[model samples]
Target: MTRETPAGDLTLANLTKTFGRRTAVDDLSLTIPQSSFFALLGASGCGKTTTLRMIAGLETPTSGQVLLGDRDIARLRPYRRPVNTVFQSYALFPHLDVFENVAFGLRRRGIRSVGGQVRQMLSLVQLDGYERRRPAQLSGGEQQRVALARALINHPQVLLLDEPLGALDLTLRRQMQVELKRLQAEVGITFVHVTHDQEEAMTMADTVAVMNAGRIEQLGAPADIYEFPATAFVARFLGQSNLIAGDVTGGSGDDLLVTAQGARFSVPAGRSRTDRGPVFLGVRPEKLHLATAALRVPAGHQHLDGTITDASYLGVSTQYLLRTAGGVELSVFVANSGDQQRFAIGERAVAYWNPRHAFLLGRRAETPDPTAPVAGEPVGVSA
Candidate 1:
C-alpha cells in the first residue's frame, strides 16, 4: 500500500460516456480534492454510477481526461489505475474466509507474508475476531465490512463506492454510515461515493455534486446546496420546500421586495441575481412561522394570510398545510415543545418568515444557515 507519488487529486475534464444512442454522461468535469470525502448524488438513472465507473476506469470515457494528479489515467485499464471500487453486493468470494478475502489484493501483487496486514485491516474494520469465518457465516454488515477491508488494503489514491449501503436495512445502514465517516477520517483518502440518498451524501460527504440528466445541476457543501438551491428541482428533490412564484421589485438594505399575486413578500437582495424579474422564491417548511392572529411581523419579515388546510401532530412536531388567500398552498412545521398552541384544520392563520430565508435561482445562499436536509430524510432529485 505504498506509492512513489503521493496520494494525488482526481480530476475529470470534459468527460463524456455514451451507449449506442444513449448519452449516459455528457461533458462532465469535476476535480475531487485530495484526502476528502466527495459524493455524487442523484436519482435512479441520473448517471451518478456511470460517472463513478469512468473515474475507476471500469467504463472508458467517450471524451475527457481522467487525471490522477498530473497523469492521465482515463486510457488505462481498471487494474492499472490507482483507484479501487466497493460495490453494493460486497463482491466477496463465498468460499474465502475473511482473512483470505482481505489478503487477496496483497497476494495477487506477489507479496508474501500478508497475515499481519490482513489482521490490521480486519481490526480497522472491527472484524478482527471473525477472520476464520467465511462470507456466508457473517451478517450483511460484516460482509460489507470485509469487502471494505479488502478494497482499502490496496490503499489506492482514490476509493470509489457504488451504492455500497443500498443493501443494508435501516438500522445497519445508519450504523454503517457512522462507521464509514469514522474510517474516512482515519485514512484521509479521497473517497468518491455515488448514491441516490441525499441524507447519505449530506451526512458523510464534505462536498456534494447533485447530478441531473447527465450533468451537474449543482455542486457545493451540503448545506450550501440545500439551503440555496440553484434550481426548482434541487429544492423539491432534496427535501420538501414551499416555492412561491413572485417577481422581484426594488430593495432596501439587503432585502428586496417581491410581489406574488398582489401580496408583497420580502427577500434578501444579496442572494438574488436580478433586481426586478420573475423569480420563484423558495423556503423550507420549517422556516415559515404560523400564527392564529395577525401578530406584528418582525423587521425584515413579511406576512401572508392562509388557512390551515390540514394539521397533523407528530408528538415532537406538528405538520400543517396552509393555503394562502391567492390559492397558493404552503407547508409549515411548528415545534410541539413548550406551550405550543394547536391550530385546527379550518383555522385561519398567518405565516411569517424572515426575508433572509428566501433563496432565488442562480444565486448565493440567503442566510448563514446551510441549506442542509433535515436530520432524517431521504434525499434525491426528480420532477
Candidate 2:
C-alpha cells in the first residue's frame, strides 16, 4: 500500500522493549530501504513479533525511536500510521463476503464508491469471482487471499505480515510461497514479513535479518547469508553443519594450519579472529566429497582419512557418516546421479573438501586484563 510522506525510509534507532525487568528487545536498530522485501527471522521470544508490533504502533517501545521516512511514528496510533498487517489467522469477518472484507478499510475512510476498488483488489489477489463468497464458504487458501485483499485495498505504505501462511498445509504453503513472491513483484510495496521458518525467509526475502536474544545476529541477502554466515550460532542455526573444534598452528596470508584431533589440517586463513586460540571449523555436509580411488583430489583440497560409519540413501542424495581417523565425526552428502556410487558401511574412505569451504570461527584465547585480580587474590590486589 502506498502513502504520501516526506519521510521515505523506515529507521529504528536504539529501539528497545521491556516487560517488568525482562528485556524483550534490546537496543536494536535497523533501516529498511524503501520498497524492500525485508524479513525479520528468529525463534519465538527473540523479539521479532515485538519489533513488528512497535513498528505498527500496536506496542510502544520502552526506549528508542521508530522513524517512517522522516516522521517519528513511535507515538502515533495504529490507524494514524500508513501501514497495515495481515495476521496469520486471516482475521476475516465470517459474516461478510470477500468484497465486503476488502471494502471494510475503504469504507472506514469514508469512501462510498468501493465497488471498483474492491473489484481491483480482489483481481490483484487472483480472487476475481469469489467476491460474493462468505469466509465460511471459502477454503483456507481463499480465506488468506481475502485477508490480503483487505489489507492491500487500503494502499498502505508498508505491509506487515505475521506468519500469514502458517495455517496452510505443506503443499499449499509451497504454492502460496510462489504466489506471494509474484504478488510482491506486482505490488512493489515494502513488505516486512516475520516468520520463524528459515526456508520461507530464504525463498521470499530480498534481505533477511537473523535475530537472536533481541539483537540482529546477521543481515544480508539470502544467498550471502547462507554461504557466509557471520557467527557460529548462524552457521549452526541456518543449516546442518559439521563443526570441528581446533586450534591454529600456522598461517600465511588467506590460509592457516588448524590442529584438530592430533592432525594438522590446512584451512583458509584470515577468516576468523581466533588465529591462535581454540576455533570451530564449520563445513556443510554437501561440501564434503567421498574420495574414491579413481577420483583425483582437486588442488587445495583438504583431505581427511575416515571410515564410513553409516550410510543412508534418499532419492536425491546419499548421506554418509564418516568417522575420521582423528575421531572427528563428519556428515557427508553425495549427489545421487544416474549411477550412484554406493559406499558400504564400515568401509574406509577419504573425505575431502576445498579449503575455502571451511568456516573458521571463535578466538583461541581470551586476553587477560592486567588490572584484574589474580586467580587466588582479591580484587583489590596488594603488591
Candidate 3:
C-alpha cells in the first residue's frame, strides 16, 4: 500500500532560540522545498539541533515564525502542528509489539483499521516477519525502523530526524544512511535531518546547510559545497585541504596570478574572492599529485617543490606531508599501486596539480592558534 502525502514547503523566518542569555539559534531563515531531503549539519552545540527543534515545534523560538506552506505554525503546539520527529532514542513503548508501536499514531487519530498500513510499513522497513516482536527483542537498527515507521505513518507534512543514527555502530549507521535516503524518495515528503556528520549529510541530503555559531555558514549541494567552500570553516569541516596564502597581483585570460613566497600561482578569475586583495588558495589533498624530483613538468599545471616530511601508506592510498623550502606545508594523497613512485621522509619531491581544481576564499583576520603546530611542521590526520 502506498501512502501519498500532499507535502507542503516549510519555511523558518528570522527564527531564534535562547536559553536565558545564551542564544542557541540566531536569526535564521531558510525554506525547505516539499519532497526534498534537507540536512542541517554542524558540530555539536553549533545550533543545528536547535534549528530542527524549532521547525518541529518542539522548542519555542524566542522570535520569528515557522511557516507551513502559507500558514504560521510558530505558535502552534507540537501535537497541533503537522510535523513528526524521530530522535536518537527509539522511544518505543517497551511492552508494545512492532505492529502496535507503528499503529499508535493511527489509533490516536481515530483510524480503527491499521492492519494493512502496519503491514506495508513493516515491509517498508524490512521487518515484516518481526511484526509481533517487542522493542527489546529487536536489534538497534530494527528499533530505529519502528520509530521511523511510527512517525512516518501519520504522513506529516514534514519529518524531523535529530541524529537518529547516532547510537548505531558504524557499519549499521552506514547501512541506515542508504536506507533513509530510499525511504525519503518513496514517501515523497520533506525530510529535515539534523546531524554533525559531514559524510552522512553529503551522502543523504539533497541540500546541506552547514551551520556554525547559530547560523548557516554554507548551503548547497554536497559536491558544490565540497568543491567550492564559501568559508574557511566549510573548507576544513567538509574535507582535508591544503591552503596557501597569496595576494592577487595581476591577471591573465579568465585567471588571476597570485604571488605566495615568490611563487606565482594561477587561479581561475571566477574563484578569486577579491579583485585585488589577500586570499587563501586551496586544493583538496586528493587533488594534488606527486612526482619524482627529476620528472619533467606537465603543461598547464601548478608545480611546487617540497621535501616529504611524512608519508602514510594505507591500503588504498598514500597520504604525504610535504613542506616547501619557503616554509609552506601541504598534504597530498595519491592512489597506491605497485608502479607508483614512492617517497621517503626528507626526500625532495614536486607536487603538481591542475589550476582549474583550485579553490580560493577571502582571507580572515584571525591569527593562527597559538597551540597548533607552527609553520613547516607535519601533522597526522585520519582518513
Candidate 4:
C-alpha cells in the first residue's frame, strides 16, 4: 500500500550504546520516513535489537538523540512514548482470551467503552471469531495476529516488531509475510521491524537498513540495497555472492580494470574512486552464466574458465560450484528453462558476466579496542 501524504519521521543522531567495556552500538544514525515499512536487517548480535529497543525507550542510549516526529524522545519512558512493540514471544496472557488480551493496554489506561474498539481491532486482524480463545488454544500464527492486534489497538504512531514471525513454520511464515504486508497497508502506520532473515526483509520492507557491528552499513530501497550493496559485508550477507579481491590497474571512461588471482577483468567504476586500492569485486550467483559456444565473449568482456565441482537442482534453477584455473571457487546459478543442459561434476565451462554486473567494495579498517588508548595518545601500534 502506498501513502499519498508523508507519515512520521524518526531520526537517530550519533546513537551509541555500551555495556561496561564493550560497545553495542557505535555512533549510528538513520532516518525512517513516515508510513514506511522499514526493516533493520543483520545477523544475530549485530545490535539490531539494541537499536530498536533504544528507539522504543526500552533501553536508553549512552549518548545520542532519538527524535520522533518533531519531539526529542530521548528521556521519554516506554509507556509515555506513542509507540508499541510486538515481541517475538507474543507475550500474551495465557489465562486471558484474545479479546481481553487485545484490550489489556486500553483497560490499563482506564479506557471505558472499549468493547467496540476491541471488536474492531479483532476484526482488523481477521481474528473476530477467535476472540473467545485463550493463547493456549491459538496456533503460532493466530497468536502472532493477536499480538499484532494488541499493539495496533493502541493506535501508536509507530509499531516496533522484533522478529514477530520468526517462530512460525515455513509455509505459515510465508503466508504471514503477505498478510502482514497487507495489514500494514490497511492501517497506514509506520512499522519498524527487526529481523535477521534477508528474504523476509526484502519481501516486506519498503526500506532496508543493513546493520553490522552496531552500525548501519547501508539504508535504501530493497532493490537498490540488493543490486547496489554499499559494503562487502552487505553484499556477502544479504545473499549468495562471489567476491573476488583485486587491485585497480586501469580506467576507461566509467569502467575499471582489476587484476586478481592471475586474471584481469573490467568492471564499472561504481561509487569508489580509482585511488582506493585493494578493492573487492562482487557479483551475484544469478548474474553469472555458463558461456555457450554460440555466445562468444565480446571484446573487453570478463570471463573465467572453470570446471564444475558441484551441482544442485532447485526446480527453477540449477546451482553450480565452479573452481577456476586459479583455484578460486565461484558459485553460478543458471535458470533451468526448457531442455536443461546437465553438466557432469568434472565438466569444463566458462563463467562470465558483464562489466556492469560487477561491483567494487571498499576495504574495511581494523577496529580499535575498547580499552586501548585514545588516538594521538601514546599507544603501541600492531606490527
Which candidate leads the pack in TM-score? 3
The residue-by-residue lDDT of candidate 2 on 1-383, one tens digit each, is 24334246789999999999989899999999877889999889999999999999999999999998888999999999988999999999988888898999999889999998888888888998998899999889989888988998888888899988899998888888888888887887788999988888989999999999999999999988777778766765666567777788878777778887677776666455466777777678889889764577888787777778778776688888777766666778899997767888888888888878777777335632222235886322211
Winner on lDDT between 1 and 3 is 3
Error of 2 at 106 (Å): 1.0
Candidate 1: residue pairs that collide:
198-379, 223-371, 226-371, 227-371
Weakest 10 consecutive residues of candidate 4 by summed lDDT: 364-373
Error of 4 at 287 (Å): 0.3
- TM for candidate 1 is 0.90
Total clashing residue pairs per candidate? 4, 8, 0, 0
lDDT of each: 0.83, 0.82, 0.86, 0.83
Off by over 4 Å in 1: 1-5, 294-296, 312-316, 362-383
User: Which 10-residue window in model 2 sums to the lowest lDDT?
Assistant: 364-373
Pairs clashing in candidate 4? none
Q: How much is 189 displaced in model 1, in angstroms?
A: 0.8
Q: For candidate 3, what's the RMSD?
A: 2.5
lDDT of 4 at 21: 90
TM-score of each: 0.90, 0.89, 0.93, 0.90
Error of 3 at 324 (Å): 1.9
User: RMSD of candidate 1 to the true fold?
Assistant: 5.0
Per-residue lDDT of 1-383 in model 1, one digit per residue for the tens? 23324557888899999999899998999889988899999999888999999888889899999998899999999999878999999899998999999999999999999998888888999997998999999999999899999999988879899999999998899899999999888877888999998889999999999999899989999999888887777887777677767777778777777777588777777666567767777878889888876567677677778788888776788888777777777778899887878899888898888777877653333532123334564221123
